[model samples]
Target: MGGEIKQIFEILETNARATPEQISTMTGIPAAEVEKTIKKAEKERTILKYKTAINWSKLGEEQVWALIEVKVVPQRGVGFDAIAERIYRFPEARSVYLVSGTYDLAILVVGKTMQEVALFVAEKLAPLETVQGTVTHFLLKRYKEDGEILEGEEGIKRLPVSP
Candidate 1:
């Protein structure tokens, strides 16, 4: 990838809402080139999804979130991919990844209520044949998410300059 393309990707990652013209202004690339690059990236699945980070608490809608650490038995041929796919297919699964250390997979799940999330783990997750064990940690509070401050101060504190 060219330097300009990488810059374009960075700009888009930071703010997906940025227009091609805006990116062109920021990157010094022509708008047409910027548009073409973005389109190609989308087609190639380099840019999977344009997402918005939402603080649902601000809207008085509280959601229960949990991180589940799963120990799984990998199938002989497919390894952990098959198990990971089955787990990720559930609607409650927000993100799923194959990780190292004690757990084979890490799953981020969201639910309307605490019980709902708990039920999902006990009923659907733990019972899977490949799933050896699972440990779930409920998110009590979110101070920051997706690199944005959710509460308290948004600006940095700086010491006064001595003249």
Candidate 2:
């Protein structure tokens, strides 16, 4: 890839809402070329989807999220692909990834309530044949998500005490 195209990708990745004109201004590339590059990237699936980093807590919506560390036995020939696919097929599994360390896979799951997530683990996840073990950690709070800070950066200002 050309340096210009790579720069375009980096700019878009950081902020998907960036317009071609804006990118052109930032990168000093022609506006038409910027548009053309972005379109090509979309067609090639390099740019999957544009998203907004939402602060759900501000909305006062109750959302329970969990990160499940799974230990699975890799299938012969297929390795971890088959097992990972099977787990990801469930609608509750938001994101599934084959990872290193002690765990074979890491799954991000969401639910309406804590009980619902617990039920999903006991009833659905644990019973899977390929699943050797799992450790689930409930997300209590999100300080930062998708490189966006949820809380505003404002430190308390204090007046020094007079001696």
Candidate 3:
């Protein structure tokens, strides 16, 4: 990507609600060019979706989040892709990734309660033919998510200087 295009991507990534005109103003690019570039990016799947991150805990609607580590035996022809596709299709799965670690796949799942998340894992996730085992770790608290601080003030962190 050219500098202008990459700059546009960064600006949009920071604030998805930024209009093409706003981005053009910041980058000193023409608004029409910015709009055309954005349009092309969207068509090519470079710009996938604009999303909002909410801290639902503040609104008294807390969601139970779980990180499940899955060990799977890759299929002969398709390897892990087939099993990964199956895992990601579940509604409970918030994010699925093929990780480089002891586990084959890492899945982030969300539900109303702990039992609900456990039920999904028990009834849906762990039952796959290629799935060998699963280890689930429930999220107790979230201080930061998607580069945004969910609690306290968003400020620079530094150690106190002593001379």
Candidate 4:
């Protein structure tokens, strides 16, 4: 995580499609060096995957997303890791995190409809042996995701004042 490597990571994070030559130009590092660094990062799992952020609303495709806060009884010796692994193994659970606060884990899930998500919660998620309780919150809208604005940027406007 030196200066040059960190800079390259930042640049690639913003635009994954950026070529090593483009990153080198912005970072002022040699293209060969940039390529080598990127390759090393990929091998080491520092760079997981190149992804595109899409605003699905524009496509008019209906999708339901929910964040479920789960309280689980940590297994003896194994702790929350085992429960987390079990929860994340489900395809519906897109993202699972061991978080600090009232809940032991927070999971992000997606479905085609609200009922489908609710059924998954009731039939799949809630029945787990380690799960103590769960509170689900559906996402109504997303203005921003992964540092990208879903809606186009709005220009600032000010009301005129008269003396």
Candidate 5:
């Protein structure tokens, strides 16, 4: 990648929704150049979709999330991809990762209530033939998400420094 491309990617990674004009100003590149670079990155799949972060807790809806460790038996002919595809079909599953630990997959799931999440695990996840076992851990609270602090502005306050 070109130096300009790398710089553009770094800026975009830091703030995905940054306007091309802002990027041009920050990186000292022309606005048209920034726009071209962003388009190229999108075409190359280096830049995914831009999205807004939301505080689900502030919306009067309880945010309950879980990390489910799934151990799966790869089918005789099929591979991990097949099993992964099946797991990703559930709307409750927010993210899925193939891991190197004892578990074959680590799935992040979110639900409105504890019971609803449990039902998903019991009725949907466990019944899959490929899935042998699963351990679910409900997140009590989140301190951060995607590098942004979620615990409000209190914890990050800086005290006065003496010279």
Candidate 6:
């Protein structure tokens, strides 16, 4: 079980969208076994979710991505979860995390334009009762995502060396 679990995770870490048959073929495990292991991993929360990596820039969607540092006042007993839930519910929010430092939360957001993102931050996010302050930084470029290079389809090339 441990070996199977490890193989499953290794395959997923390398390629998140790898099919069960591909994993089974690569690991020499039965397809049914791979399926069972994946289910177990999902149930254990080791595998949270499956997602696709998109090149939004190439899509010409006029998209803007930003990372927002947020300071929030936790409720007397509810803690950060209550406030985090509210932020995550927003459609613009792509990801959220609890981080250490001056800020309590880090949120990733995407919008159609800079103005749209700013509106979301100023009108929707900042006005929340628990939110104290926010700092936003827009992403200019990404070198890689999900272990794939964003620039081109070419893999790393090695220079010829004399024997």
Tell me which residue pairs clash in candidate 5: none
TM-score of model 6 vs. true structure = 0.82
lDDT of 1 by residue, 1-163 (tens): 8897799999988899999999999989999999999899899999999999888898999799999999999999999999998999999999999998988999999999999999999999999999999999999998977778898855756767855
lDDT score for candidate 6 against the true structure: 0.90
After superposing candidate 1, which stretches have Cα over 4 Å from the reference? Answer: 156-163
Q: Rank the candidates by TM-score, best first.
A: 3, 1, 4, 2, 5, 6
Question: Please, what are the lDDT tens digits per residue for candidate 5 over residues 80-154?
Answer: 889999999989999999999899999999998899999999999999988999999999888898888887656
Question: Each candidate's TM vs. the true structure?
Answer: 0.92, 0.86, 0.92, 0.91, 0.85, 0.82
* Candidate 4 all-Cα RMSD: 4.5
lDDT per residue (tens digit) for residues 9-116 in model 4: 999998899999999889899999999999998999999999998877779999999999999999999999999999999999999999999889999999999999
Would you list the clashing residue pairs of candidate 1?
A: none
Better of 3 and 6 by lDDT: 3
Cα-based lDDT at residue 88, candidate 6? 98
Alpha carbon deviation, residue 117, candidate 1 (Å): 0.4
Q: Judge candidate 6 at residue 90 and give its lDDT.
A: 94
* For model 3, the run of ten residues with the poorest summed lDDT: 153-162
Give one digit per residue, the lDDT tens place, for model 2 in 86-161.
8899999999999999999999999999999999989999899999999999998878776767798577687677
Q: Candidate 1, after superposition: displacement of residue 37 in Å?
A: 0.5
Regions of model 5 farther than 4 Å from truth: 76-78, 152-163
lDDT tens digits by residue: candidate 6, 43-113: 99989887777787788767788999999998988899999999999989999999999999999998888
**Which candidate, 3 or 6, would have the higher TM-score against the true structure?**
3
Off by over 4 Å in 4: 155-163
lDDT at 144, model 4: 83
The per-residue C-alpha lDDT of model 4 at residue 87 equals 93
RMSD each, Å? 2.5, 5.0, 4.1, 4.5, 2.8, 2.9
Ranking by lDDT: 1, 3, 4, 2, 6, 5
Sliding window of 10 residues with minimal summed lDDT for model 2: 153-162
